[model samples]
Target: MNVEKIYQGTADKVLRGIPASSGIVLGRAVVLRNEIFVDTHKTIQNEEIESEIKRFDIAKKNLVAEFEESISHIPPNAKDLKAILQADLMMVEDKFMYDSIIKFIKELHTAEAALVIVFDQSKQLLKHSTDELFRERVTELDNILKRFIIHLSKGEKLSEISENTIIIAQSLTPSELLKLIEKKVTAIVTEVGGITSHLAILTRSYSIPAIISLKNATHEISANDEIILDGYTGHLFINPDLTLYKFYREKQKRIAEHIKELGELIGLPCKTKDEKPIQLWCNANNIDDVKNAKIVSSPGLGLVRTESLILSLNRIPTEKEQYDYYKTIADTAYPMTVTLRAFDIGSDKYADNLLIHEDNPALGLRGIRYLLAKKDEFKIQLRAILKASKHKNIRLMLPMITSLEEVIQTKKLLEECKLELLNEDETFDHDMLVGIMIETPAAALIADDLSKICDFFSLGTNDLTQYCLAADRTNESLSEFFNSFHPGVLRLMEFTVNAAHKNNIPVAVCGEMASHPLATSFLIGMGVDELSVAPSLFLEVKEKILDSSFKQCQKNVSKILKTAMLKDIYQSMDV
Candidate 1:
C-alpha cells in the first residue's frame, strides 16, 4: 500500500512531501527566505500614476534583459534550457498581460498592486481548468510575477551557494532556480511546489534531489544545519541522530554510485537478469521530459498528454497549430515511437463546457465519452494527431475508453479525418496504430472486446486504481484505500495483458504504478510488455528491473495474487 522507506532509528523529525527529483543527499541546509508580497488595496496618488507606470515598464525591461543574458550565456548544446528561458522571457513580454498591468497602474494602483491584479486575474482563469498542465501554468506564472516583484522591489540577487547546500525556500523564481543550478546546490526543498510545477520539473532535469510541497521548510531548517533529504522516498530528515545520519550517509553513497552507473545504461537494452527484454518508454509530457529521457537510445514516448498545447493559448488551437506542435515533439523524439493519447479531459481535466456540475464527473462524462459526445471537436484533435503522424512513428491512444463501440466510433472518425486529409492531399500516416487506455473497470472486464480493436493497451493504473477501489486518490482521507497493487486491481491488469496477448498486441503500463519502484518487479512478473515511466524515475526503476528476473518475478506474482489482502500483496512486493 506504501513504498516510503522507513528507517528504524530516531531523527529530530522527518517531513514527508512529494519528490520532485530522485536521489539521496546529505547537505548543509541553506534557508532561502524570499520576501513575500501579496495583493493589496494600496493605490498610488494621481501624481504617482505616471511614475509608477514608468517603474513597471522599467521592471519588465530589466527582467527581459536578465532572461536574454541568461539565454546567451547558455552553451549551444543546452538548447532545451535556453528554450525554457526564452519561454519565460516571452511571458515577461506578453502584450496582453503587460497591457492589463498598465491599465491597472493607470487606475492608480501601485506597480506591485497592478501586477497582483493582472497575475491573479490570469491565474484565477487557469485555476478553473480541469487539466493539471493548466493548473501548473499558475505556478509558472507565479514565478514570472516573483521576478517582476524582485525587480520592482529593488531586491538583491541570490548570494552564491556553497557546494552540498540543501536549499530551503518559501518558493523559487525561475531565475533563482537557474542560479542555484549554476551553483550546483545539493538538494532543494520548497513550501509551494507541485510535482508538475516549473520549479520541480527544473530540479529534476538537473538531477538534484528535491522535496517540494514541504511546508515550514524554511522555518525548521536553518542555514548550516546538517540534513538528509530523501527524494526517492519524499522524506526530509532534519538534524538526524547519529544512527540515522550514518544510515543515510551510506545510502547516499550507494545512490550516487548507482546513479553514476545508470548513465551507462543509456543505449543499452533494458533486459532483466534472466534476459527478458523490458521496454521502458518515457512519459514525455513536456520538453524537459523529452530532454531528460533523450539520453536513452531509441527512447519511445509511451504517453504524450496534449492538454497543455490544446489549452495554453486561451483558445482551442487550430489543426495546423496542433500539427506544428505535435510534429516538433515527434521530430524531436524522431524515429522513436510516440503514443499520442488524445485529450483525456473531463470534469477532472479541462472540460469547462463539457459538464457544469455532476454528482461525480469522473464516473460521469469524461475521457472517450466526452470525446464521443463532441465528435466535431474531437475530429479536429484526431485530424491533428493523424497529420502529425506522417513520421510513421506516431500512434493514437484513446483515454477513458470502456466500450467496444467507443473505440469503433473513434476509429471511424479517425478514418473520416484520414479521408479528408487524403482529399486535401495532406500527408499523414495511413497505417498509424490505434490503442485504448485500460483505466476503467468496465474496460478491464471487457478487455477481450477492447483488445479485438486496439492495436495496443496501456493500463492507466492511476485511474484504474481509483475507479476500481471507488476511492478518489486526491481525497486525502481516501489515501489508504487507493491501493494499486490490490489483488482486484492486479487481476484486471493480468486480464488486460492476457487479452492483449491473445490478440497479439502489446500492453504497456502507462500509469504511476508502472514507474513505482515496488511495482516494477510485480508488473514485470504480470507480463506487461512496456512501462511508460516518468523520466525522473528512470534510473531508480532501471536499477530495480535489472535486479529482477522474469521467472522469479512471475513466480512471486502467482503467490502474491492468490492472496486477497492488500497488506500481504504489498508486503510480498516490498522486496
Candidate 2:
C-alpha cells in the first residue's frame, strides 16, 4: 500500500495523502516538473573560458535579480516565502560559490559545468541533512541553479501557467511554489510532500489549497482536467461531477466563515466556558515559528525540536553555534518559557554522522536511546542548552524515555555537563527545569514514578498512540489502528495527567491531538494543564477550548472511557 495515498474518498478517481494546506478550490489541472540535469565534467576550449566566466556572471546576476523580483511579487502575508527567496538571492551572490565556480571555469570547464560542480558540492553536503526544512531549502537551491543553467544555455524555463490552474506535480521546490504563487495558481496537488515541506508551508501562507503526497498525482490526472482540491481533508477529485463540486464549494464557504470566527478568538484566553484556565503554548520548529507563536499570544513555547539546527547546517553545530540558536529563540520568546527538546533524531530522521539501521526502527534506537548512546553528541547539546539557559526562560526536555531510570541517567548526564561548564567558569542557569516527554506506553504507565524525578511531563500523543495501539503510525494500511482517541491511548493520557498532577508537576500535551478540535476538549477535560500546537492552529484550538465547558467535557470523558466500542465512543463524542 502506498503511504502517500493513505486517505481517499469512496470515489474511484480521488487521490489523497497529507493535507498540506486548508481550503477548497476547483480548477483545471496543470502538471509541472522543472528538472534540469547537466554534465559537469564537460570540458571547454581556452578561448571559451573568458566567455564562460562572463556567461556564468551574467546568468548569476540574472538569477539573483529573478529571485529578488519573485520575492518582490510575493504577497506580504507570505513571510517565509520572502525569507526563502532572499536566501536564494544570497546563495546566487555567495562569494565562495563564485570563487569556486570561477576557479573551475579557469580550469577549462564550461560555465554550466562549473556552476553544476560548485552547486553539486553544496548539494552533496546538504544531502546528508537530517532536517526536513533544510533539505527543502536544498531543493529550492536546486531549482534556482537549474534556472541559472537554463538561462546560460538559452533554454526555456518552467512551463507557463493558466488562470484557475491546479498544479499537479511529483514535487515542487520552494522557488517553484513561489513561481506558482506568482502565477496566481489556485491550488497544488503533488505526488510527494508533507505538512512541513516548504512548498506546503508556502501554499498555506499564500492561502492556496494544496494536497501533497498523493501518490502519482501527476500520472493519474491530465492537463485541463477539472480538479477539485479539498486541502482541508487531503482529497483531490479528478474531473469531479457537478454534485461533488457543489458540495466542496459550499464547504469552502463554511470553512472561510469558521476561520473568520477562529480569528476573532485570537487574543482571548484559552479558558473553558466555566472559567477553567488552560495554558496554550505553540510548538516552535524555527525562529519564524517562534514569531508566529508570539503573534498568536501563545503563553510560552513548547517542544522546540533542537535537531533541526544540526540538520539545517548538516553538521553537529559547535557549542557556541548551538548556544546562539537557542539564545535567539529564547530571546525571541522572552518572558515566555521555551522548552527545548534535545535532539530527537533517529527513526524518522537519520543524521549524517549517526547512521543506525534497524528493521523495527520505531521500537529500536531513537530519541533518548539514540541520545544516550551518542554521549559525546549528547554532552555537546546539553552544554549548549545549559549555556543558553542564561536567558532564564529556557527549559530542557528529554524525548523517547520509556523508563524512570532513563530520566535519572539523563539528569546525571546533564549534571556532568553542568559541572564541566562550571569548571570552565562559564555562567549558566542551573535552576532551569528539566522535563521529559511521555511518549512510549512504558513512560505513560510509569508517569507517576517519572513525575517524581521530572519537573513536567509532555504527552507526545502521536508516538504514544502508535506505541499504545501497537501500530505504525506511518503505515497507510494501519492508519485505522493508530487512533489517538483509542480507549487505551486515552486512558494512558488520563493516567499520565493524573500522575503528573499528583506530584505537583504540570502536564502539557504537545502533539497533533492538542491541535485537533475533536481531541482538544477531551484533553482539557482530562485535566491537561497546557496545550501546545502548531502556531497556525493555536487560535482555532483556543477557540474550541473557550467554547467548551470543563464540567461538560469531564462528564463526556467519563462516558467515553466507559464506552467499550470505538464507534460508540465516536458517536457519543460526535467526533
lDDT of 1: 0.80
Ten consecutive residues with minimal summed lDDT in candidate 1?
Answer: 1-10
TM for candidate 2 is 0.74
Question: Once model 2 is optimally superposed onto the true structure by TM-score, how far is the C-alpha of residue 307 displaced, in angstroms?
Answer: 1.3
TM-score of every candidate? 0.80, 0.74
lDDT of each: 0.80, 0.79
Model 1 lDDT, residue 271, Cα: 84
Best by lDDT: 1
lDDT of 2: 0.79
Can you write out model 2's per-residue Cα lDDT over 63-165, one digit (the tens) per residue? 7777777777877656656666776777888899899989999999888788888888887655443333554555666667778877797765355676678
lDDT of 1 by residue, 446-508 (tens): 998888888999999978987899875543345557778778899989988988899899999
Span of 10 residues, lowest total lDDT, candidate 2: 1-10
